[model samples]
Target: MSVCRQAARQWSPFSLGNMPLYRVCGIFALLSVGLISFTPPCDGGNILVFPVDGSHWINMKILLEELHARGHTMTVIRASTSWYIPEKSPLFTSITIELDEALEDFFELYLQEHMRLQREGGSAFAFFKITKDFMSMLSTAHLMWSEALGKILDDKTMIKSLMDSQYDVLLTDPAMAPGVLLAKYLKLPLVLNVRWITSGEGHFAIAPTPLSYIPVPGSGLTDKMTFMQRIKNLFFYSTVVIQQKFMVGPHYDAICDKYFEGGCDVISLLQEADIWLFRSDYVFEFPRPTMPNIVYIGGFQCKPAQPLPADLEEFVQSAGEHGVIIMTLGTLVNALPKEVTDEIASVFAKLPQKVIWRHKGERPSTLGNNTLIVDWMPQKDLLGHPQTKVFIAHGGTNGVQEAIYYGVPVLGIPLFFDQFDNLLRLQERGAAKIIQLGEVNEHRLEQELKELLFEKCYRENIQRLSRLHRDQPITPMDQAIFWVEFVMRHKGAPHLRTEAYKMPWYSYYNVDVLLVLLTAVAVSLYSVFVLVRCLCCRSRRKPKTKQH
Candidate 1:
């Protein structure tokens, strides 16, 4: 509960030393006036947010609450597919809608197939097989979500109410086509809540992603690529571009057509986005060209470490000089193969350091006295603890950023998706080490853990990174809030929008410029050669006509 709510619940004349009723009421009135003074200006307009109904919702929560606290009337249109719900606040309201039944069913089937393939030792063929199915699932779900959103928009009364509300801005997750389409219909300035640093297909639509250095998120390549590695990265990046263009783009375009009259392309809305608040920072990410509209809110979800529960604190301190290691694979990954978990437990038992593994499944029999198996652990709090020696993780963007914030060196065991790329980059930066799941074994896990724990270099690198992350003039969250209101304050801040969004693909890449330069050089070379040949022929003819 908020402080205001707590005070209201405890407020009473009797509690105030038996003061006169009028005096108590006067004190209450003064407190109320103070609270009113703290409230944001009444002129703050409504801001509507539409987030995809999974982990993406978790990513948007902090920013949403901050906006509400600043006196903006915020409404979030939620989908029924969410695994968790945000805490109820009087300042923010939510409207829930169910996804298509077929989508729900397909998602279950897709999850099963995906997990099955991932567990079967992620071979090259397994990678392709899972990628194909995941793409198909994405297309089907996107279409169904679009249809579900169309129904909501088709409701005459809802449309009337939305139009009447006069919402000033629409913030949305770029992955959701429905949200983008709705923002267009409402004719509000759009802001994207991109919750990851790695450049994905959706991000490619809004900004220029150079293929030379920036590797695709899921591709198992680092920024510093050899010639062959560069070619491989290029192929991988190009394939994603093609898939988004030929496959995802057309489906979303059709979705827009259903409700948007003459219709619109999804990329059109992305191009018009006033700001792209990325969950990224330069400290962790490779240096890349960024536009003015891009805002980095990397550690917005992180906060100062609070006191741990007594039991956890006692357990952590029991390790003494050895310290503690926190291991978690993030929210989506709940289980590993029992054999793999057993091997991990075996590895943990041999280590001198105490281990806290956040396992969501049945505990393995190989568990050690030094290891504590918990269904869920406060990950950030554990990492922030001074006794923390190392962090073993799946190398998620959030997890990696947290490790950096707390100065914990990571031993990444990447399973799938962007985990590989994230870990690879960290390894390149000397702050972390990677142990691929396919290569994970007792020996490997133990070896990497030892390196991560005892190595002065690893700790030094992360501490340096921590300094860089903290040395910013303003906190990332405050910077994000400033820019969010900056958009509204300046009516979309048109000056911040880059000219890159307005250019065609060929023009943006300077293909036309290259073509013109090549053409001019070729023409000039040909003319010079022809002129020389003519001069030679004329000289030969003059010699034949004279003293021959």
Candidate 2:
């Protein structure tokens, strides 16, 4: 037979038109799905972002840029209180508002107080003192924004423009409560970005937090707590709630009343938010209660390190087989006291591993020849490098997430804010050592670094966490984008939201259930007592009748 006839004979039964009607429909359906699978998603919408300016911006920058890349239009409201960089992309819009000087003073004072506390050996009262200072700082920041908020609302032209923007969703950081009000003003679905690992009110807004295991942020307590520690944790959360109610709540309400249309309370408004994106992952954290609205996009902020510049590459490569240690206190901590800096340098000099310290001021005299000091370093690159063995960090969320992403053990020199709490949690994970700046001496620094560098357990634990962190089927970026779009596609993700939004505190906590149970027990006890008394009376009456 000819080649054409043989081919026709072999394929005749599978020909599309020659097949049954149902089979033809199935074949076309398969083709349709294949075409749709490769097709890019196009359901983009206007997304308004409100990230607190200055260092807070860095936390959300990667996610914001990724949103823009995925074709969502973003409008950012930047405050002049901190540094604001206009996004280079055309898809982004920036509106700068002049903020009060209170924020700047707050940070300066915070650093001074933090250093003083660290220098003084920690006491039983340390947690109380630190919590008070942190709350005070937060209060000061809110007052500054309150001043700027009045101006923002007074600007009729700007208000008119923003109102007309017709944004589909409002994304705001938990640090920026004004952003919550802005969402209400725009009448858009509110999505929160909790940049910190734990925010008291933020978690409470989503679901009830059990303090037994979930350490209070900034409490200087870990996930594994003794009975005393749990009591302390309870006290920490109680104090936080009290402060939020008395101090932070009023400020937020006042701002919302002035700016938002409906003028709801901050807590109530927060509950109605569509989704909460936390800067935390389960691998580095204890398993805790979470609702469908909660999503952990922890390492989403971290990216593959770009190629290091020529000088940096040469310096890191020079370490050879010994590897390098990247030490950075992050952008917020611009400089440390010279004495403390000298202590760190002294320890670095003795180690065989090379040190790349990110410091702005003049180099310390005790710094070794193996050490490389720079005004700025590629922190992510250095941490991600194959030869990068350990990271000496301030335990900031950004730095810690990067270390976890790359499976590098950390020698944490905690200063202030959540740094102490972060290191405490990581220490519980067995992948980090917390070196309080106050107690940091030559011996402590040298000993801690040696343990972190040489210890097999540290590396093994971190590597285990690294695998879990990286073993996700979907990239963090994809997961984040998927949820964001899921919200948009489904119109604020009502299905994913919890009934906690609708329930009162008493009902949600099952106080009503407890009350009912108590009532039922009381009724049952009364019935039993009556029956026993009646039986005793009947027995006594029978004896009297027999005597008669």
Candidate 3:
């Protein structure tokens, strides 16, 4: 059994005060010692990282390089995904293959199946059922990916390839739950690095409460269940939980059994990590509720400002002081409908200032001389340029962070998911204006861009937040490194963990306890009142009879 399981079994509800405190402390202390002993000093050493290839992987690359420069020997396990390019640099000590051709083929098949289902017409009920099934299949695919990763770690030949490398710490993205298993199997301290707002709390470090359990922040919307949405959110939560339970739980168990000779809960396995690091500034994600183990190290991915390419810089500078507008929809969702693109192009054609759009394909022939389209651009370099006035973006977290980092006002055309939330937050902070994806037209785009270019307050507001962000005691990277090292040195600090796990659903909200107490008091008072009434009636009847 894992240490957490042992502690849970030993814990007594009635004798909470007289529990074996020393043993608990001893176990935690020993774990802490083991973690710290394995952790190299702040100077950095061998660190093994698992690769999750995507646009977000870019951030990890910067982080790895920063640690490498500080003397860390960085090794990466390359997962074959189109999102990551393994040949980008020679920083990795060794790249281990984690994906098989069969799995890749299966994933492609599943994707095609789901896409076909989406394209086919069906009844409303059928559509809902199909979507749910699709989500389930996608979740299973993710689980399969996690299991495959675990199998790779379990392989003796694979272990031989990695074990000879003499790595110190294992760092990974939290989404890859397999990382937690690998860390446990290797008995290495794990550092969970989150790239976006994850927990329910927007920015507060409080324990996660369900979205329905509290009012949705900023929107003033109470998740008061309207029978339907409640059921939907519940279903959503259940689907996610079930997926995690099946995928993460078994993989964790298998890894533990193979490596640690023990069994453990997936949650405990995750929480057993030394530290949880968030790559976000508190100002942007304020009111976020998280566990004590969680730390905010936002902007760690941000680097010192770099100059733009000479020709591009010259073109932007020569825009005759009106300055150029920088627009990008980010990497994943670049393929906007032709109508949307035409509308965007139409708006840009009329603008006096030059427009530099990071479009994926060929520039439209109708676009004016002032407009430039490129397949890719150095985003940060462009953002930092003084001649760059307004930003039109898809409102990605990294883009939002960069905009705030440089104090550039944004015109956000949020596409989906947290992009909406990020845009909402930016608008609430007076740092940007939002144009819904569905509502984007030439008129709307032109008007919003005009307002953003002319608005002084927007620029000022972003600058204010930028100042606040920069005023942090240390850079996010330093803070992340500190906590990561802290966890390794201290072992797992259970003391820092909150009582969230111990509380029942009703008790967590104090609803059941309050209801029970109220019911008991009401019942007791009613019984007493009834008894008094009976006595009075009997006394009155006796008096009346005597008089008669």
Candidate 4:
């Protein structure tokens, strides 16, 4: 039935125009290389997935695809208002919960406003405004998600169905923590496909982060910090803590109180996870303390390059020796501010390289014939291409990982959120250069672009990273799968999970131990002082007796 088998059965060597033995051997080589595939057998397991609806879903979907190929059944819980998480898919069965309105469009409206504020910002007042606006938006998003989660809980039939399904594991993105709640409620082994947790970066929730060295996400500092920078990092970290404690925590508190016996705190629940498939590697991330259960499976989504489409191939080939430059701002943003785009486009026009930019909205007036603008691109393939010289991007996790995978240097234009932090990692490694939106102009863009392109260090550094990433004993994807299935093989991995979450804050930090030790030391010191005083008094009394 197979092509190789069919060719073998036909026995066409004599019929093929008197072919030589070497040509016949070449046919066998083709069969061995192309027609043979060794697919490992799989044990089909049921997996329940809860994913956030935007860029987070992309990673979740890729993981699900791999699991599905390995004979796993998947069920996804999504919102009716979700544009990205469709109601139907071949890979997973969907359970769509209705929402009052689409949240994705709501987020985009605010994204535009944030970009506008960032462009206009020059003073402390402007920074305060951005932080205020972001917190308001975050609270609203949490409020909506919490309400939607409440709907799922209130449904008796749906609850019964989920319980009856008896899923082996619940795979979730913890950015939106309803999945975590569901996993706990169902008592399934929780495996998080995570980068961001409920309040901030995932590490802070589960790992012991020393503020002395490990920089906070938005502080824009590296592992090595100055005195003032350490103070600034602490301040930034406090804001994240306050957000989780005061603002976002309250949104879910009501639900937890009503549903669970012991009222659940989401952060603690997150720390109790059986496995955290963290979406970062130390090669790309700053070195920090990590837990036993946390698996580093960064760049799991990347793979070898695929052939380019005919038209795109022709365009790339036209660049010849100068090579091509690829620029994209990720899924959330369609376009940058007009002035910024005009500046970037103008600079691209002046360069000798070919450009492929993924952009929407108004085309820049200064567009060049060398540059091609499209609504979408085969991002990974483009990065993998030999002709791709440098990447100009927004510094999302996916894009950054891909750039590292393919050994491409970047000139980053970080707009908002963790984009700056993500890009800063590469800049620290000397693989990228960053230009802010507020600072963008023809001169800055041209200078950075040329530096990234012509400077041999940028290319060399990223390539070295690529080697480090590739030299692992096992692939990241395989490592992730092994862990996921390991969870399934054992009902849970509580052995690896630390009991640190259950301990009180005082006990966890050893404040109680410190207090006991301090008290004992003080008591011993006081006794020694009293004995010494008595001895001195006796000596004085002896002298008085002798004089009498």
User: Number of the top candidate by TM-score?
Assistant: 4
| Model 3 local distance difference test score | 0.68
What local lDDT does model 2 show for residue 191? 84
Q: Per model, how many backbone clashes are there? A: 0, 1, 15, 0
Which residue ranges in model 1 land beyond 4 Å of their true spot? 1-43, 86-91, 102-112, 195-203, 509-548
**Residue 211 CA displacement from its true place in model 1, Å:** 1.5
Backbone clash total, candidate 2: 1
Tens-place lDDT per residue, model 1, 284-326, is 8888777788888888778889889999999999999999999
Cα lDDT tens digits for candidate 3, 1-548: 99997687667543355657777677779989999999976555668786455656777888787776766667777655434547446677656454554434554455444334433433576456554654455456456656676677668887786667655678887555666667776677677776422222222223475656433432323335465655566665564455456633564555556656556555665556556677666678645346667788776767667988898888888798799899998766544656667778888889889989988754565678889888888888888778888888988778988898888999997654356667777787888898866578878888888888898998899989889988977888888777756654565455776665556668878999899999999999999999999999898888433553
Clashing pairs in 2: 118-438
Model 4 worst lDDT window (10 residues): 34-43
How would you encode candidate 2's per-residue C-alpha lDDT over 324-383 as one tens digit per residue?
A: 998889877777888989988998999888999889866788999999888888888877
Instruction: List TM-scores for all candidates, in order.
Output: 0.85, 0.86, 0.73, 0.91
Better of 2 and 4 by lDDT: 4
How well does model 2 score by local distance difference test? 0.79
Minimum summed lDDT over a 10-residue window in model 1 is located at 195-204
Candidate 3 Cα RMSD (Å): 16.1
Ranking by lDDT: 4, 2, 1, 3
